[model samples]
Target: MRIAVALFEDAEELDWAGPWEVLAAWARQFPEDDVEVVTVASHDGPVTCAKGLRVLPDHTWETLGAVDVLVYPGGVGTRRELADPVVLDRLRTLHAEETLLASVCTGSLVFAAAGLLDGRPATTWWGLVERLGELGDGVDVRPDARFVDDGDVVTAAGVSAGIDMALHLVARLHSVERAREVRRYIQYDPEPPV
Candidate 1:
């Protein structure tokens, strides 16, 4: 599975890192699966994360290949990304290609803005569900589900939820046992905080 993780200026670090860590572990555990996880940004160079951390993209949006899955992470930049036509257009393009879409936290706003969440059940950070209603009717905002699976599109709530979503993706793509093994390897079985 070729997964393209999208990053832009001010993207939340954990939203991107949580999934990346889980998936990177999955790749390490099952090297034969050939699951590719590459970072892509609006531009072709380094991008600063919401925490002021710099991340270099593996490819530019225009050069990304056939993506089986697209992951968008939200950050302090989301309030501004709401008006970014480039990000919205990229979301449109990825959705049009029928790739599995996933988002963490306010990243759902990008999908909502791109019209991809229209009539699709989804979620985001606890308090931001109201803003997503503008995208479509019957969004079925879920504040409790760590990750909501609505077929091709899966949305996770908050930052750590991305880890759960990644394991979910592993189960979906491979097997439940494999997902369990990966979770065990990462010691993700214990929930320390509510």
Candidate 2:
């Protein structure tokens, strides 16, 4: 499976990195699975992320020929991307072509902006849940889900939540055993301290 994680200027690092780590670990541990994880951007260049982290994209939208899945990560930049017709149109096209579409944090907002979440249950950063509903098209915004798997489109809430979503993707795409193995290899037994 080929997974393309979308990168953009001002994108939240963890939103993409969390999932990348999980997926990359899976690929490393299970080379037989043929899982390829790559970061894609609008252009083939370095993008300055939300917290001023520079990320070099492995491929551009033009070069990412046939991606099995697309992972869109959100950030402060999503506010601007929400208004970009080009981005929305491209996302819509990708949805039509890709087998599965996943979003992290406010990435769902981009999906909503692209009309991908229309008439579907989805989730995003807690603070923007209401704003997501306001986007209309009958989006069933779930305010409490760490992630919502509504068929082809799966949305993860906030940043760290993306790791959970990625593992869920592995379980769904491969097998429960494979997912568990990947989790074990990554030592991703989360115990968040309040």
Candidate 3:
């Protein structure tokens, strides 16, 4: 399975990195699973993230082949992507090809703008739930969900939530045991101190 994580300028750091950590760990731990995880950008140049972290993508959109799954991260940059015809068309094509589409935070906004989330059950950053509903017709916005898995399209709520979504992807694609192993390997026992 080939999983491509889309990166762009001003993308939230944790939104993509969290999922990358989980999915990449799965690929590393289970080489026999034939899982390949890669970071992709619209261009070949370095992408400056929302927090100013520069990331060199593994591939550009033009260079990427058929992807089994696509993880679109969200941030302020997604605002521009929402109106990008090229990005929207690419997403539409991917959807038509039956590629599993996943989004974190405001990434769902782009999907909504691309008409991918119309009449679909989806969620995004808590603050943008209403905005998501406004963008797509009949988008069942789940304000409380950390992530909603709707078969081909999965939408994650916020930054750290992508980790949960990614682990869920591992379990869904492979096995519960394999997902557990990956989680253990990553030592992702979250205990948020309040």
The sequence of per-residue lDDT tens digits that candidate 1 reaches over residues 1-194 is 89888888999999998888788788888898888889988787789998899999999877887989988898888878878897788778777888999999999888888787788789899878888776656677777778888998899998989989989999998899989988988888755777
* Residues forming the 10-long window of minimal summed lDDT in candidate 2: 90-99
- TM-score of decoy 2: 0.97
The numbered model that scores best in TM-score is: 3
Q: Taking the tens digit of each residue's C-alpha lDDT, what string does model 3 give over 77-139? A: 999999999999999999999999999999999999999888989999988899999999899
Scored against the true structure, residue 12 in model 1 reaches a CA lDDT of: 96
- Kindly report which residue stretches of model 1 are placed more than 4 angstroms away from their true locations once superposed: none
Candidate 2 vs 3: which has more lDDT: 3
Q: For each candidate, what TM-score against the reference?
A: 0.93, 0.97, 0.99
lDDT of 2 by residue, 39-93 (tens): 9999977899999999999999888888889999999999999899999998888
Winner on lDDT between 1 and 3 is: 3
Q: For candidate 3, which ten residues in a row score worst on lDDT?
A: 114-123
The CA lDDT of each predicted structure is: 0.86, 0.93, 0.96
